[model samples]
Target: MTAVAAGSYPTAPGYNVNVRSGPGTQYRVVRTLPRGARVTINCQKPGQAVTGPYGTTNIWDNIGVGEYVSDAYVRTGSDGYVTGRCG
Candidate 1:
């Protein structure tokens, strides 16, 4: 598994990504990040399995303290170890 860095800015490629309260769609929607939005990945972990224009992945990126958006809609340039793991 790769870590999405704490300050790395990953972009949303296709449409808007739903920023959720947690790492899955089961969580409430905190906001919607427009396409091309630079998301600051605070940490990353495997959560819900999500598929988007990019593909399917279990990697969920923490954008803020509790704000999470799936890696499915986020292009982090690499598939692994872009940042540290969440506690």
Candidate 2:
């Protein structure tokens, strides 16, 4: 699993933005992040979590999904979260 600290941009296209209670697949569906949403990776863990109200969250990272996005999916630097399309 990749170790991405909080404040890192997602490197995958059309990545499933599954909202969790904490930060894993185990948590309930807080919401799903739309494609190109600027996500600030927070933490990383091994395997999914299975014990809380959801299940097992793991093999992923956490982040604070931005509220609104502009036409700038590409992340050049860590200034803030951005989403759109990259050339």
**Which candidate number would show the highest lDDT if scored against the true structure?**
1
For each candidate in turn, the TM-score is 0.83, 0.42
Global local distance difference test of model 2: 0.39
Cα shift from native, residue 67, model 2 (Å): 14
Runs off by more than 4 Å, candidate 1: 1-7
lDDT of 2 by residue, 5-78 (tens): 44545433555445555533445666666665566544333434333222222233444342221112224243
Ten contiguous residues with the weakest lDDT in model 2: 65-74
lDDT of 1 by residue, 18-60 (tens): 8988878899998888877888787898889998876888888
Best TM-score among the predictions, by candidate number: 1
